[model samples]
Target: MNKRVGNQTVRLESKPRIISTATIVGPKEGEGPLRDYFDTILQDDLNGEDSYEKAEKSLLYSVITAAIKKANLKEQDINYLFSGDLLNQIISSNYAARDVDIPFIGLYGACSTMAESLGLASMIVDGGFANHAVASTSSHFSSAERQFRAPLEMGSQRPPCAQWTVTGSGAAVVGTEGNFPYVTYVTNGKVKDYGIKDANNMGAAMAPAAVDTIKQHFMDTGRTPDDYDLIATGDLGKIGRKITAELIKDYGYNMDNIYIDCGEEIYDAEKQGVNAGGSGCGCSAVVACGYIYKNLLSGNIKKALLISTGALMSPTASYQGESIPGIAHAVAIEFGGDKNE
Candidate 1:
């Protein structure tokens, strides 16, 4: 049993399952087409919290507990909690983890935390080191604006290329056994920076990383787009998705029939006027843990590849004239695959 599958991808032999999931979104996301997929939709971003950052922590903690409850497990029963967020030092996940007694592994993968955490959890569970692990992440628009650009109170004018950061959180329970979607393979993406400097145009910055990881996943797994029902990117929005599609197509992956991005699907791009679309750690989190998870549970989608994309840059790096770097982590989940695989 060596589970390693080539350089970047790892095949899981133990079959870790998604026992349960929970998602909470703000009013803007709640108004989207997939509203019913979420477990809770807040009327406002703060929900009486003093600040958007605190609201973000509240969202993460709430979702973690909700997912645990849905799985019929106690907090102490969770062996480990994998979590992350966009705020400085990942304060949202740090503070949220404090309220729970489970061991925590805080991550900072920008928007890719959801998939990153899930892949890691699956690895540990598949290795027989843990029976149950929880993976979760969150993001807030107002808080992101304050940290990345200007506060919303400044009434900043955003360019058409700018995307709206999602204000939401998503949590999921991964365990050794369940009649849920099985985590079969994990592809770790390399950091790919194309000298992008603009903080607003994250899609352009992260598209190359997405393409690189996706192309490698196919190469390593010996599978193509036709092998899976869908390939979903965590965020990437419209601009990034197009860039990824065009680039990966150069490698012979015609994904037009099976590809979609969570960012583009979360908002009504035409009616909402969100410009490019949505981008945030929560953008893909809520969609994957909610919509996609539910769809998998219902057997509507037999196999899916969730590649959560991230822009690995900060306000400090941007101010210092450093170019933005991007990364993407892909996790392959399927239903009723070969029993021994």
Candidate 2:
């Protein structure tokens, strides 16, 4: 009954299975290296919606539906829905869940919402609280830009360090019974700030938090980087990824063998115009729900550690010159290791 594994880690005895997953991405992301993994690719970022917010909501709804459909469940069959977005008051998730009959739990962890929601969903099912639950998140370049930086129409020149916001959404269906990829452990993170003020440089602000949570995960699990076929940070992009890789080395861990950032993996830095890489809540969501999930099913990766990072800063806080704080949550998932009994 006691699932606490360490100061920050929880070992889920039930090992809730990831029943199904779905990913939808914008044209830019669809053009990236992991294009084949995504379920739907929009020719236009708006997805026929007049506003980016509406498009993001649509993306969230579509992916959540797709995941559930893949699991052969209807909305009435789902016990709980955990979702969020970067929009103000998380309107994308709130409005999308507006029509669903399932109990809704809105989350807010910036770009880390995907992992935050997924971790909680897995726990709920693992604790016998639900038979089936859903976790999802979404983000859009236009919506995020207008809120966090400048309006897209203004065409403001962004600095080289700025990463592109991923216009996409991802969802996963978690169930108590299945032989699919299982959620074994979750390591929650602490908020960290290093006096970084520029919103454009989120990777730098968030790198320390990624490093801290990952280091804590290793310490708690007694597992090295080699234990996982892949160790992915949510959206540290190039700068944050480099910083995390270097800082983690100081903790006596060598992650170079299998470590990668979802941001960098989402886009081709050489061919894409995206300055550093991709960011936003959708970055890790789509990557994990699409590429990683498929690989797990294919037996290409028996184990994976997904660490989603977030820069906890509001426009008002940033305007007041408050330094950005970062947070990360790591979920340990494995296939062919355990089955629901």
Identify the candidate with maximal lDDT: 2
Alpha-carbon runs more than 4 Å astray in model 2: 338-341
How do the residues 1-341 of candidate 1 rate in per-residue lDDT, one tens digit apiece?
Answer: 88888789999987799999999999999998889999999998997899999999999999999999999999998999999999999999999999999999989999999999999999989998889999999999999989988978899888888899999999989998869888989999999999999988999999999999999999999888988888999888899999999999899988999899999999998888788899899999999999888888898888889999999979888888999999999999888654223
Q: What is the lDDT of candidate 1?
A: 0.92
When summed lDDT is taken over every stretch of 10 residues in candidate 1, the lowest stretch is 332-341
Name the weakest run of 10 consecutive residues (lDDT summed) in model 2: 332-341
Model 1: runs farther than 4 Å from truth? Answer: 337-341
**lDDT at residue 39 of model 2 (Cα atoms):** 97
TM-score of 1: 0.98
- For residues 1-341, write the lDDT of model 2, one tens digit per residue: 68888689999988899999999999999999999999999999989899989999999999999999999999988999999889899999999899677899999999999899999999999888899999999999999999989888899997889999999999999998867998999999999999999989999999999999999998998888878889999999999999999999999999998899999999998799888899999999999999999999999888999999999978899888899999999999899753222
- How many angstroms is residue 77 displaced in model 1 relative to the true structure, after the best TM-score fit? 0.7
